[model samples]
Target: MATTEAVKAKTLLGECAAEFAGTFILILFGCGVVAQVVAGGIGDHDSIAWAWGLGVTMGIYVAGRMTGAHLNPAVTIALAAFRGFSWRKVLPYSLAQFLGAFLAALVVRWNYTEALNKFDPGLTRKSQIVFSTLPGNGSTELGVHLWGGFRDQIIGTAILMLLILAITDLRNTAPAANLAPFIVGLVVVGIGMAWGTNAGYAINPARDFGPRLASFLTGYGGAFKDQWGDLYFWVPIVAPILGALLGALLYDLLVGRFLPISDEDEEPGRIPEENTSA
Candidate 1:
């Protein structure tokens, strides 16, 4: 039994590592596309959006079996808080995700140094830097951008979380298994179309912070810290948690409450049969 438990522990560790690697790839490819397209490089809006969407779809499918593909720390925290996941697992999962994202950004920098240098040789110091929002005009204008961006992220994340909870239901789990990646990708696409202009549609904190940190370290000579004063970083981090909680609670009230079993799909309890033998 002890040996079996040890093996299980090793398996979990492997799963965690895979999750981190998968998430890192997702961000590197997805955000790398954005940097190429939007940050004064060669790509276009449609191309960048498609890249991000495809990256997310593929990442979820690749990592779903192992870590539930929770590349987003907000998703991990919300699940642990509301879905009876062990809280103890949340920190390690979040840490792994952040590390993966940071490493991925580094990879993006290594790959794109030439393009970045060509685009802005004067700003070549900003090469490995991933994209995030800065005040487009000035501090007064920043408020409007932040509000709109926060609202969009909140709504988009709420819908995504709602879909996640519904898909994970035992009765619905099969369909969710088939549709989860597509649904998630579509959600990202919509957010990009609608909100990408303002705050870069950073619906996931790990997605933003990890790459931001990576860009800071490898390129831009650590200029990523300059954007930290925008006073809205918390929106990306906090609003997603609120949105996820809202989604899980709303899903529970609407669908979960009506189900025979409140939790997993094993049914509430078993009935005992009486024996008639003398």
Candidate 2:
């Protein structure tokens, strides 16, 4: 019993460590590119798109072998609901993700402080856009508004989760030879291209909330809310969770219904296997 518990503890530690490292790598490149564009004047929207794509790709490659590389809490919870993941693992995974993201944001902010000072001079919310997301800039009457941005986030994350299921679903044309991670990264690119501008397409709560918290601590003043009368913080968090569940249900209803349900569908410890011993 002692040995078994020790092994379980080790496995849990390793899984959480993988999640931490994966999220750290994700923000390192993803937000780093945003800093470069906003503060260093190096890239454009295409660059941000590719940066995020490659970030997720590398992050997955880092942790895919362990803990299934669920760098997003929404993904974790959605899998728990639809993909038979353990409900017990959700909170720890989310905490690790938030920590990794916050640490990465700290490093990014440190690396770009001078440039940020030059760009905006006060660390206000305008400059904080490098760390968090906001609504559009009014292409029409009085701008797109928070509700529209909320809708965008919901649909955007829904698309993300749906494509994730499609790309990883082996029975339904998933990629060959362990290329699912790369394909998932490409899905992020497509989503960014389509929905990045409106609220920055923050489909992952850790990707935004952690950095936003760091911003608040570093003198941004209520990083979750803005002077524009927008309670924007919960939008990314809640919308992504809902959107992921919606997307998974859509996939299950449309495609997963026809696929063979394997031992993965069994309860956490009730997996069955064929015995062939003499």
By TM-score, the best candidate is 2
Candidates' lDDT values, in order? 0.64, 0.81
Candidate 1 structure quality by residue, lDDT tens digits, 170-205: 665535437767777776776667666555666677
Which parts of model 2 are misplaced by more than 4 Å?
Answer: 137-142, 261-278
- Provide backbone clash counts, one per model: 2, 1
lDDT of 1: 0.64
Task: Please report the TM-score between candidate 1 and the true structure.
Answer: 0.79
TM-score for candidate 2 = 0.91
> Which 10-residue span in candidate 1 carries the lowest summed lDDT?
269-278
| Tens-digit lDDT track of model 2 for 159-219 | 9888888887766776889898899999999999988766788899999998988878887
Distance (Å) between predicted and true CA of 130, model 1?
A: 3.5
Question: Best candidate, lDDT-wise?
Answer: 2
